[model samples]
Target: MQLTNHDAANPSYWQARWREGRTGWDLGGVHPLFSELMQEAHAAGLKPNARVIEPGCGRAHTGAALAKMNYIVTAFDVSKEAVDAAKVLYANETKLELVVADLFALPSNWSNSFDAVYDRAVLCALPQASRPSYVHACAKILKTGGLFLSIPFTKLHISASEGPPFAVDEANLESLFEADFEKVCHIEKQHSVKDSKIACEMLIVWRKK
Candidate 1:
């Protein structure tokens, strides 16, 4: 599979998927790994009211969960349809701010604005070449010494010709974050996904330096 900007693996392609309700990637709700990570963060002394942002926050389940826990949660997605769905899903929660905005083109008013950023199915969703800019944007929006928690899909079967859920090995993941973050904890774990076990989901928690 040739990984290229012209491939069906770009952001516009994902936007179209959401428009057509073809988002197999939409898990309908929060992933269990996220819940476990939040539990760990709480145990590690993160306060309830921390400012949190979720980029590419499709359906914003993580935002909803954080809001319920009293965090000031903000979430954004480039696809307006996805944002609309998230709003409907999280309507009763006043603690979260859901906006339709491109991750790379975030509003100028938001620099250094968040205490922590949580991402799942966001970074790895992008085409491989676009990841560096995505990482840079995440770093820019995060406050100095803030936290970044990511659950990225790794070791997925994909040819260069196919993907929206792109694969990331340990080396690729490290190359994406090591320059911008102070690595804190990295875990490679198996996750139960419906009828099968996904053996290569990696969880990374980083403290912005």
Candidate 2:
């Protein structure tokens, strides 16, 4: 799936991409880091029925994983095709609900509705100019003291020619979340993705404060 002249910030562009099967961002499964983090959270006695929300939930794989663990999961994506695919994939699983909606304009019913939020490719998917509002919307939808888990691309060398897996350094990420949440943990790992030289990325956890 390749991007053309589409505007990255537009929901219609993303919807069209999904319909056209141009989802380069889809990992085909839940992220390993998120699986590990959820396991650790469970080990530490976090309730299995916690309300979880995932924005930009491409195919909603993470939400499906959480639902399997007994979470009340609600996931939304800007692409109708993506959301519809998720609904069909998770259909018979009462624990998961998928919605087609833009992250910044989340449904009013979701305000302060989640106990935890997962952001996999969401933050970096936005154009850098829209990041502040994107972060703000994430904060707005979370309950006070709610948990946030994010995996963002970091310190990656990329040619000006390729992107959408944009580079986001630690400082910019910190500045984005600091105002709305207290940083709890930040972990860096080396991961390999085909055709990309970037092997190091960051996973951050924050508690809404």
Candidate 3:
């Protein structure tokens, strides 16, 4: 699962990871950061039954958890293997929908259809060149005033030159979405990525305007 920046953009890279069970990012269950983010967003007016879309949602543990919390969750990944695994893992979650789709080429009907976009791995997983497009796709699918909850890896464990878990700073985040979103809430906290020198992470919620 050693992916160069160019290989990171190819869907086959992710497909191979899933097939080989090389998903170090898979926590095997919903992360507590998601619960905290939901609580903060709910205080900020997000409610159950709101339509939520999660792009690059490998295995969809968070999506299924959100569905149980009453959100209408649509979680998709470029890897069919990942989506298929998610479907089987949470087969009884009626409110959860799993699909194999590219984030940049989502279905036409999805435009401005989601009330929120949950991004745990998508942004940081992509190469720097594709970030603007990722931000655009998320914004396009979200309705006006929709929330975008994100947990981006703020520090890289490996070399800066090679990564799926890319390092992102506040400036990079702001510059990318300033045109379409306004920062409403932000929290920085410690994380536990194995062998990582920096244990910092960020939970940010932006409101679409």
lDDT of 1 by residue, 22-109 (tens): 8776677788788777765665456888999999888998899899989999998888998999998999988999998888789988
Candidate 2 accuracy as lDDT: 0.78
For all candidates, the clash counts are 3, 0, 0
lDDT digits (tens) for residues 19-129 of candidate 2: 779887777878767766775455433578999888989889998988988999998888778988888888877899888888877778888888888888877777777
Q: Candidate 3: lDDT of 143?
A: 95
Q: What are the lDDT figures for the candidates, one per model? A: 0.79, 0.78, 0.86
Worst 10 residues of 2 by lDDT: 37-46
Q: Candidate 3, residues 1-209: lDDT per residue as tens digits? A: 57555678788888888888889888788766777888878976889999999899998999999899999999999999999999889999999999999987889999999999999877888887889999999999999999999878777667657677777888899998899999988799788444354457888999899
- Model 3 TM-score, 2 decimals: 0.94
TM-score of 1: 0.90
Model 2 clashes, total count: 0
Clashes by residue pair, model 1: 1-160, 1-161, 2-160
Please report the TM-score between candidate 2 and the true structure: 0.90
- Candidate 1's C-alpha runs over 4 A off are 1-10, 43-45, 195-198
Cα error, candidate 1, residue 165 (Å)? 0.6
Clashing pairs in 3: none
